[model samples]
Target: MDLEPPLSYGHGICRPRGFAKDPLVKTVPAIEALHPEMTEWRRDFHRHPELSFEETRTAGLVAQRLRDFGLDPVEGIGKTGVAAVIDSGKPGPSLALRADMDALPMDDRGGKDWHSHTAGVAHTCGHDGHTAALLGVARHLAAHPPASGRVVLIFQPAEENGLGARAMIDDGLLDRFPFDEVYAFHNMPLLAPGQAGVRTGPTLNGYIVWEIAVEGVGGHGAAFFKATDPLQAAARLAAEISSIVGRYLDPAESGLITVCSLQAGHSHNVIPAHATLSGTMRALKPEVMELLYQRLETACRGVAELTGCTIACKRLAEVPPCVNAPEGADRAAAACAEVLGEGAVIRDHPPFPFTDDFALFLEAAPGAYLFLGQESAMCHNPAYDFDDALLPVAASIFTTLVRQRLGYAGTHARSVAPPST
Candidate 1:
């Protein structure tokens, strides 16, 4: 159940050997037609944001919607994730599209009309928008099945904590609903609202969090020289580790280290015997992460020697980088180009510093993870909210990606089947 992902998922995605040129934008207009309903769904989710592994009502709503669209939705994958299949009753290839469904543990300060109804739970990451957009795709796909193939729509949970993707994989997500390729996307801040970025290489970095525990003899502060002060060691380590991101890595390469939390003495008069320092290290390449761990252990050893403290470093939640396969990347770029124009897709963008659980999905199956540009407040910020105007855009992107991946060409391109919302 805890198997690590393959070292690299470099195979071509499921398509016509190569990516289709300029994915047909036939469904773009139809997706635009469903904008109002999609916005309603997104706002409803925004008002009732749920935290990781607890998306009961959100999952229920998605399930009902999928059912209404005439697809059999299976609940309870990866705790609160949902997966539904559109078999098309024919055979070609299976493609999977995923969107996360969870909110961060924070108060809503965006002041939107449909801000979080629950205090300390907010959808600052734009997952509400992602869910709604996927729902739009679900309705569209249900009404107009591809000529031949299966399309699996996955509504995942716990993305903020970086475990949901793995949980779903372990729960036989791949075995139960196997696909030739997989895809997912996240909204980005500060970019044009109608554009997206997709590349064929590492799109996001890998990260590992380390918690360092140091223990030394506690003694009276009046005679501090007599005792090994763990607090002093912790202070020194925290400052030095902060420089690791910029100092340790090459000037041209990308890496980050954040000494976020430190805990030590409780009383002013006494030097505490125990202290802990915790933070994270991120890098775009696997080798960089390896080198980072080595440097971290070296830092711990050097600090311990200087402070005469016993130090123990524990690595937590080491997530791998999310790289997009060539086929999937091309398909995604073409889809974006078809929907929003060629200028809307960035094929050679740099990797993001943050980590995504979707990395695990790409590792399991050759796929791509894209970023949709929408001018808005940065994610994870208290005031951040997904731009409602981007709903139809993302939905169009999803629709085009699916059609291109399945090679839905010719007459099927122009028709809009009976509406399903």
Candidate 2:
């Protein structure tokens, strides 16, 4: 097999040539040619990461890029979300592609030259890369207009706290950009590069973050029965919290509950009057999550009764399970296979333990969530970085979905013309 010389651009992106010879790989050559631009956009986003609902700069840049691609973008849909459309001017079903745009409220230690400049915000979850890839798709679609149907591009905010999708929906996103189906992707380090994971039904879990407060009287440390100890009550509740899933849920069903943070005393000699515990519970089903909540309340009540303290439990945030529509999942798998070869698309993988707000989009319309393989530390890790190589790979998969599902007539595949020197 002869390999063509690597394509080099001004920004130093060298893509391996000769993809046409491989029968299974159908990645768009034009998208691959846009690698340098995408890399620049991605790194720019990385350097200026923003927290949820505060993506003014990121949204502005994304809107400007969409405009540069010759598409009209509507900004501020979900406070800081942006949406644009590319219509083929023919009658067919509408498709929506979404990308998240918020960064975690954490410090970046990735050590890259383009690492986050924001003091307390970073794109540790690869939202920066997701936005850039989708922007590439926007440019490609604008250049090579689809022959029929509408392709909606959505850049959403606040996904880190699982509120972006709902925010958009509440802001009439579905009504304004009405799509028959939606699609999104997240980068995963668990799989090898050049691979994609697509699973039908229950691709990611639903979760709820909860907090419990235990109140008791403050007393001297040496006193035996002078006062009730809230710290001891909080500790007992924390220990019992882990047992709720195993005791209430079925042996085969998946459930989780963990006490992540506990606060009570500030000194060593005095017993504090108040103790608080916070954690999360997750399940693949809504009813199971509710069950876990009920069990948690029961545990708190029991501990309060046993330790003579007043206990209160509260649910902070809730995101439902992300179950993929069968048809959408099949189409996504085929599209990924087109870009990464048949063997690179995995369909037998188990549901991921993480949660995504995209689940809400699936509830509103039929769609699928996919995982793009990458070589890096897992997302949310301080040292994590997004792989630039997957930029074209993901864009091609999204583009293939448009070409395959929304047919393009009379347009032969053409290589992208390099920018004028």
Candidate 3:
């Protein structure tokens, strides 16, 4: 169950040759053949990026691809999301694999030939790569069904906004698909290409966005006694809120409260009537997140009262932390080792501050979220691109995991269990 093997940089332990020689590698030929198509799909997606809950074309593309793969595709389950079901002939446990399908509101600076053609919107977070990888898996699974279970392929939207996962759950995604285990992968630029990283639990921090508005009397700046400056209230609120993390949060719990933006008066000589502060609170535990929210609210109200200002705090988006199931993590580690060799896998790494909606699915089912090294620029950067060379390796890993879980070998393995009631 311990897959945290020592790793060396540029060791080339799991070369493409080893993958090509493996039997599972042969099953990837179809995926490889569709690589060009996949790339085109990715580029097309990149060129026409869509923001959260507005992925009309993206959803249509995913649905069409699923239909072409001979699976039953369901659309609009989570507001522009798509889910495809691939049933095996026999009966067994059901599994779900998910990928995000949203773009960020940023312009592409990657300068790639297939850069985003859309203005002020791009796949800077590599959701396009995620979508492509899941599509690759869907193709492979369609051709080579599992022996004893069903696979639900989910193309989720609004991950960038941190709402898609919850939206899907709210729409009864689990009730409809009913998966025993769900798995997801994200491309990481921090690691080298073809390398895989997995943590047993709590791979990402919980994040909540909050908006604070302070209102006070506006007056001439020269008359200090005449006005209650909202800007001063905003400043005090920011400083005091930051102190809560340092003083209130447990030292053992990793937490951060960053006031990312502050907006106040337009005139330099006039005290503003209102000021606004917006930022995020990140912590590794739900209790920590809750505590931080309470403390933030108390500080905002206290600062407002102390400054003779009125304040309002609103929660924008709250995403739960991702905790990989122990069993699923062990299985994922084993599959990675089997596909990429033991030495190529890094099992232990510090959890990240980034939040993912995949945590929602994991909360519903026993599952593991994995990070695959892509050797590209870090996510959220316009220069980032998914390492296409890792396609076969990733495909191999997914196939191996499915085979190991279902006790099947070779392509075309059918089902063995009944659908979940």
Instruction: Name the best candidate (by lDDT).
Output: 2
Error of 1 at 108 (Å): 1.5
**Cα error, candidate 3, residue 351 (Å):** 0.9
Per-residue lDDT of candidate 1, residues 1-421 (tens digit)? 0112223222222222111122422236777789889999999999999999999999999999999998899999998999998876777888899999999999999998998999999999999999999999999888887767888899999988888888899899999999888899898763455557788988888888889999999999999989999999999888777767667788877677778899999998999999999988877788888888888888899999888899999997878888899988998888777765676677766666678888888887888998876666788888998887677778777787777767553465655333332
Instruction: Evaluate all candidate structures by whole-model CA lDDT and list the values in order.
Output: 0.82, 0.86, 0.79
- Local accuracy of candidate 3 as per-residue lDDT tens digits, 1-421: 0012233333333434223333322333455566677677778888888999999999999999888988889999889999988788678888888888999888888888888888899888878877877888888788777778888889999998889988988999888888999888887666655567888989888789999989899999999589988999999998898799889987888888989999998987898899999999987788899999999999987887798899999999998899999998988888877765676677777776678878888888988988777666777776776566666566666767887886553544433222223
lDDT at position 144, candidate 1 = 81
For each candidate, give its TM-score against the true structure: 0.88, 0.89, 0.89
Better model by lDDT, 1 or 2?
A: 2
lDDT of 2: 0.86
List runs of model 1 lying over 4 Å from the truth. Answer: 1-27, 243-248, 409-412, 415-421
